[model samples]
Target chain A: MTLLECKNISKKYGEKEILKNINLSLPSDKIIGLLGKNGAGKSTLIKLINDLLTPTEGEITVKGKPIGVESKRSIAYLPERTYLDKRMTVQAVLTYFSDFYDNFDRQKAEKLLAALDLDPKERLLKMSKGMQEKVQLVLVMSRKADMYILDEPLGGVDPATRDYILNTILSNFAQGASVLISTHLISDVERILDEVIFIDKGQVVLQESADELRTREGGSVDEIFRRMFRC
Target chain B: MDFVFDNNIPIYIQLVEQLKTYIVSGALAAGERLPSVRELAMMTKVNPNTVQKALGELENLGLIYTERTNGKFVSCDSEKIYALRLEYAKNISAEYLAGMKKLGFSAEQAVIYLEDLGGEDFDTSGM
Candidate 1:
């Protein structure tokens, strides 16, 4: 069964159409990279899937149902912006998540927090931007959701922290769960991707397995993207 | 043992070669059980499916084996491992010689450089 499917999906804000006739079906048990440049409507597409925004046209299904409460429940999303309350302590935020999501694993989050040396008593506002990102990742990953959607996960962090983020994601990966990672930093996360969907100018220019893309293009995904979408 | 990857190459293939090197170098001792696929994935920061693919290749090469109920194990067949080690050694040695040759050294001079670098037993017969 496909984890998520978006058919003829398009979104508009007043006069600006962000995505156009987008068709994508994500299968279980793969790490798929959603590659695109800034302002390429990647965030808009993600928001549409999470039901944070309604698409102007077309439909999206999660586990074969239209985007609704069940679809929302099935997807664990980390949006580009931080959504945690600034005043809440790390432990308090974990409690907030646990109170909301039935699948949230408090114990697992605690373990990950300890591993990353993040203080549970510290307020989210007190932590550095990098640490905040890690904390957010820990919370999101602790949930055993069917599909994990991470947006710009590698942005604005040191390389070492970025690596930890990747390891945390992989470590929490459940069997048969698909991960849709939307990032512009192709080189950093490209190795872990099983499939890649390249979105250019609000449309999917290419969707292929990562290895096949590499083999066919005779270059890394980053290199191919550079040449394909050169300025 | 650090496993480095080349972005230009298929990651699973690199994993296979690196894991084989671990077996060949005794870093992964003979008959030792390997880590679970998820554990390996976290350690290497690759996807679980790709790591499994690499393990599958290692199993096909007889460098690793599955014990069914138990996890994968490095092969207990010491001779096969010895043969693999020799093959890797020869390939690496040839690469080193080629590098030295590219710097305008004759085969004999390259062997002398290898000797100085403690690369003993570089047979000069081919020269």
Candidate 2:
């Protein structure tokens, strides 16, 4: 079944259009990469799916229903920016998540945090930016949601840590769940992506199987993106 | 086993090739039980679906098999393993000959150079 669908979606700000005629249907049990350069409206599309921003036209649906509280219940989102309170410790944030989301698995989150070498009792403010991001990822991924929407989960990190994060994503991914990852760092995430959606200037340029694109274009998704969107 | 993947190629295809290499080279011995898809995926740091796909391909190729609910295992057929090893050696030989040809050496000259460089005793160092 299609886990999420965006039909004729568009976003605008007064005279300017941010996204136009965007149509995408994400299937279950796959990792979909939303690839584009800066200001390509990747975040805008994500926000729309998460119901943070209302589309100017058309509709967005999760499991054939319009975005709402029910839809939010089944979608776990990790925003591009860190949203945790600096004063709160990782443990406190985990408790907050546990209380807020029925599907939040506190034990799983703790295990993931420990794997990253993050101290649960340590305050967010005391941790580095990358560590905070890892905590955020752990919290989001611990949920047993139908879909996971992560925006730039690999934005700031060392190469070694990036591999750890990718491994965590792969290891904890449950069956029948779909993940939609949006990022400008294509090469790092390309290997795990089942499908790739290229969005530029607020419109989807291409959406196809990642391997099929690699096989047909005779290069990695990163190379194909570079070739198609070169300056 | 660790695998360094080239992102240019399909990941499942790479998995299939790498697993084949391990089986033919005895790194993964015949009849050796393969890791579960999830375990393989975590070990390989690739998606589970990709691992499953590669395993499915290997099963179709008769390089691996499933024993009901037990688990997947490398083919125990000696003839099959031998034939696969021969095919791999042949391909490597063809590629080596082609490289030598580009450097202005005939197949006969390549064989002579190979004998002089390393006779019957194969040097496994720096491999």
Candidate 3:
């Protein structure tokens, strides 16, 4: 079944259009990469799916239903910016997530925290930016949601930590669920992606299987992205 | 059990090649049970779907087989595996000869050079 679909979606801010007539249908049980350069409306499309921003035209649906409370219940979203309370300790954040989301697995969150070597008693304000991001990832992934939408999960981290993050994402993976990771770091995440959506200037230029793309283009996804969007 | 991949190629093809290498090298011995797809994916740090595809390819090549109840295992056919080892060795020799040819060495000269190197402790660290 299609996990999520966006039909003729368009967004406008004032008189300027942010997204064109975009159409997409993400499949279930796959890890999809939403790839684009900065300011290419990648976040706008994600926000529309999450129901954080309203589309000026067209419709967005999750599991065949319109985006609303029902859709939100099925989606675990990690926005690009930090939204957690800075004063809350890691344990408190876990409790907060468990309380808000019915599918949240507190034990899984705790296990991930331990595996990542994060102290539950550490305050969010005291943790570095990367550590805080790790906490957010643990929280989002702990939920037993149908779909996961992560925006720039690998942004601004060292290479070693990036590998750990990717490993964590794949290790905690549950069958029959879909993960949508949006980022510009194509090479970092390409190997793990089942499919890739290349969006440029508010339009999707290509949507294809990652391995097939590698075979057809004779290069990595990062190389193709560079050749397509080179200045 | 390091499975490093070149991003330019299809990951499944690389997985198939690496697993074949393991099988022929006796690292993954014949009749040894294969790890679960999820475990292999985690170990190799790729998607489970990609790992599944690679295993399917290996199965088609008669290098691995799946039992209905039990998990997958390396093929127990010693003759088939021996044939694969010869094929792998031939490919390596061909590649080395191609490299030597690029440096203006004939096939006979390359063989002679290999014999000369084999007679001494050829340290690869300098290269």
Best by DockQ: 3
TM-score of every model?
0.93, 0.94, 0.95
- Model 2: chain B TM-score relative to the native chain B: 0.89
Kindly provide the TM-score of model 2 when superposed on the true structure, using C-alpha atoms. Answer: 0.94
Give the C-alpha lDDT of model 3: 0.92
Worst 10 residues of 1 chain A by lDDT: A167-176
| Cα deviation of B64, candidate 2, in Å | 0.7
* Best of the two (1, 2) by lDDT: 2
lDDT of 1 by residue, B1-127 (tens): 6878888888888899999888989999999999999989888888898999899999888889999999999999999999999999999989988998898778777878667774565554555
Score chain B of candidate 3 by TM-score.
Answer: 0.87
Going through the candidates in order, their DockQ values are: 0.68, 0.74, 0.82
Per-residue lDDT tens digits for candidate 3, residues A118-157, read 7789999998878888889889988888998999999999
Instruction: Please state the error at residue A140 of candidate 2 in Å.
Output: 0.7
lDDT per residue as tens, model 1, A86-137: 9999989988999989989899899889987877899999999999999999
- Location of the lowest summed lDDT over 10 successive residues in candidate 2 chain A: A167-176
Model 3 stretches with alpha carbons more than 4 Å out: B101-109, B118-127
Two-chain complex of model 3, DockQ on C-alpha atoms against the true structure: 0.82
Error of 2 at B111 (Å): 2.9
Off by over 4 Å in 1: B103-106, B118-127
